[model samples]
Target: MRDNAFWIILQRLRTPLIVIVVTYAIAILGMVLIPGLDDKGNVYHLSFFDAFYFISYTASTIGFGETPYDFTYPQRLWVVVCIYLTAIGWFYTISAVISIISDKTLKKEMIKGRFVRQVQNFKSDFIIVLGYNRVNSEIIKRIRKANIDVVLVDHNADIINLFQLEESSMGVPVMVEDALLTSTLKDAGVNSPYCNAVISHFYKEEKNLRITILIRFLNPKVKVITRATLHDTIIAISDTDIAKVENPFEIFAKRFEIALTAPHILILENWIYKNADLADKASYLPEGRYIICGYGRLGKLIKEKLDKHGMDYIIIDENNVGTDEMIKNETFICANADDRDVLLKAGIESAVVLVAGTQNDIDNMSLFITAKKLNPDLYVISRVNTMKEISIFEKSDINWLFMIEKILINKTSLQISQPLKHSFLKRVLYKDEEWGTSLVNLLKAQLGDNPQLLHLTINEEKAFAIYHVLKANKPIGLNILLKSLANWQNYHKAIPLFLKRNGDEFLLPSNELLEIGDEILFACDAESREEIELIASNIYDLHYVQTGEEKRNWLLSKVISLL
Candidate 1:
């Protein structure tokens, strides 16, 4: 692509360059052949060098007066012709240059060339985001906060331009091109070892699937994170190795179920994702008759979960055409859910839960407000279609809100930026409610509400001090990392949430002996995380934390002995 840009410039300006060269050659030749007279009236011809130099300034309209003598009649006549010839040639060349500069194809190639260079020169890890929108913009912001670079590719020039206009301290390189093309991905550096992951969250499942297959073939090691809402699409995407598929409907349904059966588990998961504070108490969903508005994909998924729990519910959608026979016959009302008559038909007055699951934000908000007017005690859950109206929904004080954009952003960012933490959260979903509650209590007790999740590997790169000590056959336990440097007797406000060694997993393994290749995930505050890093990388700090006394270096030890 970089070479393409260079070639494009040459190709576009080829004729203009030829014209300029020929014009200069003709002008210089005329000057050398024509006769001129010096002050002494000696007839002489200008040298090739002087002719070339005179034409150089004359063609540019600099008009450094005539050089080295006065011209004879024929010489003056030829000079006039040369002046206009060069001026016309220069004008044509300048116009051609301007035309090429304004050409869209050339501009795209230049931008792409610059983008390719940026990706090639990238030193740190980066993720390539396929499309851009409010969701992706938010994802990029969060990813940047973690000090990771993000490259964006979008087909819409307007969206790309809008994003570029935003006030971002760290500029994100963007390419305005079709993301579905293999060439686009290649230019984005899908094969680069530094390219950590590729994110494709297109609305079309087929596009995402194609991207996953392309990335797999191009670089099987690069993790692919994408979105797919359908079961078949999800299964197809899952077949590719290291592909993290996010189904917003499925995720929301599972979360809704957790809120019903295990509120604490939902709370814990939210805290881990930084969606909620650990100090915030869990609000359990009431189990009773429910009213679900809209019968779209999201609505149907919510209905499936409700049926799984064997809960009584009614679905009210404006259009019930092409819906399943069972749904049409069973507690489904064919009317606008926001209408008072529809609410009464759906038994909203007696329903304990009302889900405004429409794809439209305004309709969902209307349904919730109307339902709440009838039944003030209704536990309302609404689906927010766009982020623009989020403030309106928040101001309405809906009990539980589901924003598909937010769900996708959180899930995709978590999986890409923090794979280990992503894995831990996935395992957390399968654990029993009792286990979740205990973990939540533990996190709150030790790391407080906003503890940062840190993943550490005992290797030469990540933990030099600890790796060397383990290599030298020195025994170090997980407890050593939790000890404070100030006082080894007191532990830091951190906990070992998970440990991995030799394909075995241990949860909350305290006082366990550390190995050279052990991977550990800790939940701790910022201060504790820094302390842990110091202990892992600095030998003296590790020694101080391990032993009560600070270990001195060779020079310090000799000076102390002499003293």
Candidate 2:
């Protein structure tokens, strides 16, 4: 298609080019045919320079009077002919220029050419985002802030143009195409070694799945994160090798489950990691019957989790086509949730929890306000799909609003900023119940009641640093490192998370001996980062910090002992 478009443009240009060349030839020949005379009336033949100069001025309509001699009738007539010919040529060229400018295919080719150049010249590892919706927009913003390159691919030209206009030079290279096509993926350089990850944030589950599969097939090592909104969609990709599937409904459902079974744990996790205000804990979730408005995919998932826990709830949505059949035993109301009458019918005054799960942010906010006005003590969970709606709902009487876009952005940011820590938390700590609990408690005990979750790998003015032991040729005991940390500044704030030796990992034992290839991961405050770097630079430095004595001479000690 691209090649065809380029050829079409060249073919269209050929006519104007030929017309201009022919006009120049005829105009020059007419000038050369005319003769010229000197001021003395001595007849002299017009040189090629004079003919070319006269033709240039006459054709351009500049009309500088004839040089050295006045124009005869033949010369004047020839000048008229040259003017008409040049004007026609210029007009034809202008028409062709307009056609080329207005051609959509030509414009797309130019943009694609620029995009290809940017991709080929991109030096750093990048993420390829397969959509430009609310979630992917937020993801791109986060990725840009982290200085990682990103390429956006979508079939929506208007959306891509809006992004380009809004972001200007800061905009990512975007390709307008159906992202599910493997050709599109290849064009976006998904198979390149520097392409680290691909995020499928398409609205359609099938498109996201297809894009994911294509990305994985092309680059097996590149991380793929897909968004699936339906239960069946989740099941479809569950067995696939996709790295992560972000189902907002499922995530919300899981959150509700945690809130039900382990409320404190949820509170701690949210307070530390999610930037939730702990002072509002009392109003976060009040005790009452749960009323879910909008029985859409999200609403249904919430209901499923509630039913699995055997919780009391009622669903209110106008769309009851197959809803009644789906909800066999649960109460499902068929009414517009925005209506006040619908609120009263759904037991809004008595219900402790109100969930606005519809896709429309206005409808969700209206229902939330109505419910809040009736029962101020009710805990409302509002579903917000866009960034603009977030501010609006936040001003209302809502306890918590789930902006799934924000959630996905946060997750992707973590993955980009701290891959090792992110992997460790997700694969190791998060999977093991006991370990997760211990980690939560450990963080809380060290950092405080509501410390923001942070890894010390990156340098920050207010953040700490974590150093890894890459090469320690000599045997270094874990005790020596721990003792060295104690003598350093802010030792109380520094803690060793784990020590990995060989293929095994564990909490640092008091007397655990470190091997040549062992790695110790420890976290310390910002003030202690410099000192920690020094200790990590050399294995012998660990001994100096531990014993406050430098090893100076084995040769002198051996010589004296031998004597």
Task: Name the best candidate (by lDDT).
Answer: 1
lDDT of 2 by residue, 1-563 (tens): 64555777788899899999899888887777776556877766666688788877877778788875887677778878888889999888999989998999888877877887788887889888887877777677767876888888889899887888655228488999888788888889887879888888767788777776666678878878887877677766655676688877766777776666555445444553446633324222455599988877788778788878777888888875435554575487777888888788778888989898888888888787778888888888889987876778777768778887777776666677555344443434223344445555665566544433223221222111112332323444544443445453224444566555556766533556555444455654454444555554544555466557664567888999999
What's the CA RMSD for each of the models? 2.8, 6.6
lDDT of 1 by residue, 1-563 (tens): 34787899899899999999999999999999988998999889999999998888988889887788877888888889989999999999999999998998888888888888888999989999999888888888878877898889999999988888775425688899999999999998898899999988888899999999999899999988898988898998999977988889889999988887887888778887877788888777887898888888888888888888898888888786435765556788778888998789778788999888887898888887788789999898899988899999889879888999999989888777776777778878877678888988888887777788889999999999999999999898999999998898898898898888887888778799999889899989999999999999999999988778888799988999999
Q: Looking at candidate 1, what is the lDDT of residue 26?
A: 92
Off by over 4 Å in 1: 35-44, 62-70, 321-330, 447-452, 486-490, 501-504
**Stretch of 10 with least lDDT, candidate 1:** 320-329
Assess candidate 2 and give its lDDT.
Answer: 0.69
